[model samples]
Target chain A: MITFLFYLPFILGFVVIGVWGERKIASFIQDRYGPMEVGPKGLLQTIADLLKMLQKEDIRPKAADKPLFLMAPLLIFVAIFAGFAVLPISPAISGADIETGVFFLLAVVSLDVVGVLMAGWGSNNKYSLYGAMRSVAQIVSYEIPLGITVLCMVVIGSTLDLNELSSLQGIFTSETTYLFGIKSLGIDVTQIGGILSWNIVQVPFSFLIFLIFFIAGLAEANRAPFDLPESESELIGGYHTEYAGFRWGIFMLSEYAMMLLVSFLASILFFGGWNTPFPNIGSVTMATWTSGTPGELSGAIWGAFWLIFKTTIFVFVQMWVRWTYPRLRVDQLMSLSWKYLTPAALILLLLCGVWKMLMV
Target chain B: MDQMAVYLFYFFGLLAIAGALGILITRNLMHAAFLLIAVFLSVAAIFVLGGAEFVAVSQIMVYVGGILILLIFGIMLTNRISSDKIDTGFGNVLLGILVGCAFLVWVGDYILTQFNDQKAALEQTNNQTEKLGISLIADHVLAFELIAILLLIALIGAAYIAKKDKEEVME
Candidate 1:
């Protein structure tokens, strides 16, 4: 509950930063000033937008389904927020700490499809319906590869618990960690504890798996080149076209929050959540200094620092990809998921299974 | 914790029943679909209250996420005979009620007979997912494999049918 409360404000703050950051990044990539007026570097632009949104009249179409129209935004926000309850911030600080944390997170987050459907159908608008349908279809299709990649990690780790998964990739692991799961090589990366211990490094194939995961995560978060659902040129705001004021703000907030969630998951699964990238190179002892022992206050602080740091990097990459690439057509999007990523992910899953067997 | 579980059970159970009733009573097809999601969710909650977290999550993922979305998509794409509501014309009312009553009675009797045994088994179970996995692989491997093959066949058949339909449209 405490973690949940903490995340609520964190998400809100992240949205304020994320919106401004996205605009600035987009501008910089295009060689233009982003937001310069509001609060030095336009930091207060999102805040100003929020205040303006709050005061705007909540408009509803006369033909709209009143109950569903009113409930859709709340449902979308709540469903997305519920996913954070299972995500561990650090070794010492986590939300639910459930054994089925990863599975539960995936399940809860997918409920937003229902909310999106509600928003589209209840609005009784053609564009909103088209947006909702396209969004739901994209998410559902992308989830196949996304789930397969995550399953690849789960196969290698032999655990679904995110905290356990995180611990296994760092100095805190209780089991012996062989470099690339090859014992005959006679190299153990565990004690060295840095990039060597991270999942992508320990299991070399996981880098490919992580790439697939990253692409799938981008699609799942509705970021371009997969943001066809909200293609402003055609759909004009898509599912939230009928939505106005704070309701529309809620949709934007959830989109940014989803981006952050995916970044956190990517870092946690591949880059080693809350674990320092610096190795303890003999007398240097940088890894130990950076990532304090689990359960200590210093541990929590360092853990949060590294996790947030890694997450921010991934978030920036997501923004970079969004601005760099053009939006994919609907057919192109579906083909990428079903034809390309799905096959690649399935092969990775098989390879991961074999790798797990070899490690055993 | 035990008391809380009991309260949660009652809360979700009532919610499930209410949602089911709403689905039956609702005039709009979309409303009925949404009500069905509520029922599915509450039933998943009941699964959680029973200490079956894995099952609960799977229930939500497969039913609410996969199946319900497809169901809603179908509802949205279909041309409605009416403007707002999909008219549900009733037929064979007496036979429908009789069959429903008989099934309810049979299920109620079965649950009554097995309740105590199931409760005892549930209490003894811990780390249900691990145990479930072991049993599925070691004890019921044949059944699991058979189900997987069945689903694969069904998927292929559906794909073939869809492809044929598209080819027909193209011609």
Candidate 2:
């Protein structure tokens, strides 16, 4: 409960920053200035927008189901917030350090779909319904590949605990003991930990797994070009079409929060959660800084700092892709997952299984 | 911890019953689908209280997340929003209520009678996932393999059903 309270504000604060960063990145991609007046480089633009949303009149469609309509956004918010409960910002800072952390994370994150469906249904709008349906298909289809990739990581890591995964990628001393003699491959020159100890680098076929996972993560988060669910040219505003004011803001908040959550998971699984990429080569105490010692305040602080740093990079990439690519058609989106990603993930899973056997 | 578990069981048990009642009484089919989600979630809570965390998460992921979304799709895609009522008719409704009551009473009686006599030991292991994985690979390998094949066949059948026929394409 204490961990949840600590992360609640931390997550909200990050969401605000993420909103501003997304706009700035979108503008930068299109060669324009994004929200420069609200604060320095429009830093406070999200705050201004939040106030504006609060002041706007909350409107409900006459035909809408009143209770479900009112509850939809709150449900979405809660689903994302619940997902945060399992995510470890630092080794010592997590809401629930349950053994089924990964499974629980995936389960809670998938709950967002229910909220989206409810929003679309309760709104009683055709476009909203269409958007919801598309979203359901996309999320469900992409989830298989996303899950496979996560399983790939889990198989390599040999643990489902997020905190343990983080510790396994420590700056100086990582979990090379379980590398199944793959550490003798000579690619990992510096045994004294760094990027080489990261899952994407250490685990066999992990590069491909990371690629597939990243793309699937993008789809699951409904980021463009896979944003068929809400493609403005086609579906108006998608499931949140009938939503307005703070209700609409809640949807936006959930979207960004989901994006961050996926990005953080990617970082935690692949890029080394809260572990500095630099090795302990000098007298700089990089090991001390990156280590997740439970009682050490510096370790906790730096651990969180690195985690946020890696997660931010992934979020930026997502934003860049969102602005750079044109949205995919629904058919193309379906084919991309079923035809390409699913087969690729399956093959990769098989190959990784073989690789693990060899290492063992 | 035992007290907490007992309280949680009562809470989720009531929640599950309430969800079932909601499903029965709700006029809207969409609302009933949502209520089914509630029932699924409460059942998952029960599984968690029993220390089957993997089963609880799987229940949520597969039933609540995956299958419930499909149910919602079925409801929405059929354009049944405005006409969401499930017409059981007067006689059928009474029969359904009577059957439901009788079934509940029988189950309650059975549980009450067997509760003390069948006080099975709780799981001593914390690593249920590892145990589950091992059993699936070792003792339950054949059943697991058969289930995999069955799922594959089901997938193929679904694809066959969904695909356009050659005659339709020619037309």
lDDT of 1 by residue, B1-171 (tens): 388888999999999999998887777778889989899999999887777889999999999999999998888888641247564656797998999999999999998886856665556366677788899999999999999999989988987876756667898
Off by over 4 Å in 2: A171-191, A282-285, A288-294, B80-91, B117-120
Report DockQ per prediction, comma-separated. Answer: 0.60, 0.66
Q: Compare the candidates by lDDT and give the number of the best one.
A: 1
Clashing pairs in 1: none
In terms of docking quality, how is candidate 2 classified? medium
Tens-place lDDT per residue, model 2, B5-100, is 899999999999999998877777788888898899999999888877889999999998888999888867676654444443235877888998
Report how far off residue B109 is in candidate 2 (Å): 4.1
RMSD of each: 1.7, 2.4
lDDT of each residue in A67-165, candidate 2, tens digit only: 888889999888877877777877667548688888788888898899889888888888988888899889999999999998887876678888788
Worst 10 residues of 2 chain A by lDDT: A172-181
TM-score of chain A of each: 0.98, 0.93
Worst 10 residues of 1 chain B by lDDT: B80-89
